[model samples]
Target: MNNKPYQRSELIYKDKIKKIKDSNIIIFGLGGVGSVAAESISRNFIKNLTIVDYDIYEVSNLNRQLYSNYDNIGKKKVDVLKENIKKHCKDTNIVARGEKVTDSNIEGFFNINYDYVIDAVDDVKAKLAIIKYCRDNNIPVVSCMGTGNRINPQMLTIDDIFKTFNCPLAKKMRKELKRLGILSLDTVFSKEKPVETVDKKLGSTSFVPGSAGLLLASYVINKIAFEE
Candidate 1:
């Protein structure tokens, strides 16, 4: 086990670095947001990770996905991210599941005793299910909302779902979560109004999604390193 890889983090965290290494983290979705979040967590000395994603890298994903590039455009996102994480954090134990997390299979995915679960999946049904499952089970979860259709990285902030606004996705999530009796959740959301696009397709940039992922990573890492 080469602790040298996280030497700088070890300085501030001291022996608490071991706590991070022992953490069991699961991230759903390996697109622009989840890919960066997974990479950031792995580099921070998280040893165990279960990454779930069924998508393949397309040329279009190169704009924001950390594991997407021209060379791996046709490859599976979970496999690509697992290989990349292993290359950097040799001691980390990463399990890549190339499958989508839906209501039908959600129970199987959360069977393991994960210390942290990141809900980066965009589907409203899946996202709400994961969040409700975590809340009901008393698990720590951080959800990312609407990194697309925006340009400002500064507008991204971490807060409960009900406290977020200006992003359409967050607004919808707030209503859904409230109906489910879930009053609070840690979420990364942008306060910027989405840009008007003629085609009505979500417009995204390289930085917006990347920044949201980083913020989610930082939030999780800090909680593990300090709060734990």
Candidate 2:
């Protein structure tokens, strides 16, 4: 009778549980991808987590977003996520920041000094700001790219941003990062050619986005928990 909340993770990871629990990670964006990543991280007994998002849940989000539901509609993502994680994962210290990360306020936004940063944002400028800030500070970070419009979860791969294919978002980020002389980025990207949408709005799937989110969390956790 394993009575511990995170006994499963503690069991498999063995002596690495404390390192996993001590990881101070911050994730930006709480849509389908980031929300799922937070859940995975929290379940792994990550004790310190910070989730940032300025958006509220909308009716449209229920289709793919992990945290979106009728009860949470119109509620801020960070607040909902914070409430949920704290209630279920009592050992975690969750910080919910309802501010949009932008170029102007980025310095203040990153005041907490996370050991690992996850970029799950959709905005180009916001993503750029986050990567650059982390790069400058020498903090390890991973960015999620183009999970939208992708259907095949198996096609998703984690690699350097420079090598990612079939992801328009990765292509755009490549050009911008090059201009900034940022040579490399740890990225989670889909190799699936996106199914074009007639309305031009990014289409999403519940599985792939959440899968990518798990990949992001796994990458971060592996570094923190398994590294020598």
Q: Write the per-residue lDDT of candidate 1 for residues 159-213, one digit (tens) a residue.
A: 8888888878888898898899888889999999999887898888999898999
Candidate 2's C-alpha runs over 4 A off are none
lDDT of 2: 0.89
Q: Each model's TM-score, in the order given?
A: 0.95, 0.96
lDDT of 1: 0.88
Model 2 scores worst on lDDT over the 10 consecutive residues at: 106-115
Positional deviation of 166 in candidate 1, in angstroms?
0.8
